[model samples]
Target: IQALPVSKTLQLDLLLGTTQRFVRTEPVRPLFKQLLEQVGAGLGEGQGLDAMAARLAAVEREQFQPFEDRHPFVWKNLLLNEFAYAMFPKGGAADIERELMGIVVKFALIKLYACGLMAHRGADFSLDDVVRVTYVLSRAITHNRRFLPNLLQTLQDHDALRLDVMTQFVL
Candidate 1:
């Protein structure tokens, strides 16, 4: 694929292919660290979305940290959730297990990207994916009331939306 210096458009194809690489080399730790770092540095310098996105887009697989230490509780919830489960394919136990691992990796990357995008005020990343994640997180909060307050605070701090607006949207 052509590697362009452009916005933070996710290379779904590349990401899907990344699962194969995980078997060979160790996965990136602090998952998506490169992307997250770039977002922080860019925003600190008061850069715009286009600039931030371009910088984020240029990150290669080698730059990412391994996903070896993510919280099991969070990942488990994400996998079993209705929205995430729909993406799983039907298969035998072995095949299902393999596919489930890939889905876990994919979701981790998505969350990494989502968190990076959320870090910056008015910074647009992949809105469709972000919204989908937002939906899942919202559902999570509903399922467990404790998450609602923390999520609201995060939204307000990130400037994704006003706390009131986010409350209505999530509800």
Candidate 2:
């Protein structure tokens, strides 16, 4: 696959580019949303994060069809495993609300990553679509789950870089 010129300035261009291809061709949003819901539901009635982590560790990995004629990929499994560990790095239980927040933020990060990857392909999303997606994610976190201030700040900090790449793509 030919890399878009803007891809050079974007980190993880190849991985994100591959991910973007899958994102464009497949129903990835639903799968990601479902997985997030399933994991969130696993924290029912104040369940401990450790328990949910253990459950995720045992769950089978999901396979997604790659773009065009490429072979299927197991990215979901990697995300699940890595996020599970990252959520509770010290191997201890966190408050259920906090745990759910972590899950929400992680999913949001993945979505953001996908958006960045789309830019790598020179696929421009409308500002309205971007606002809608941001609203949806923020609402999801604020409504049923806890808010993550740190994650929000981190995302905000990347706004300049994101805009720079988009500007480069546009130019």
Name the candidate that leads on TM-score: 1
Highest lDDT model number: 1
lDDT of 1 by residue, 1-171 (tens): 143232242222122123223323433333233443443553332454455444444332212222213233544455577345545666766666444433433354445444444444233433454555546434433444433343333433545323233222211
| TM-score quality measure for candidate 1 | 0.29
For candidate 2, what's the RMSD? 18.2
lDDT (CA) per prediction: 0.39, 0.37
Off by over 4 Å in 2: 1-75, 87-94, 122-149, 152-171
Q: How big is the positional error of residue 75 in model 2, measured in Å on the Cα after superposition?
A: 4.2
Summarize candidate 2's per-residue lDDT along 7-88 as a digit string, tens digits.
Answer: 3223222222233334455443463454334324532213453453333222211111112113223234434754565554
Off by over 4 Å in 1: 1-77, 82-84, 87-89, 122-171
Worst-scoring 10-residue span by lDDT in model 1: 60-69
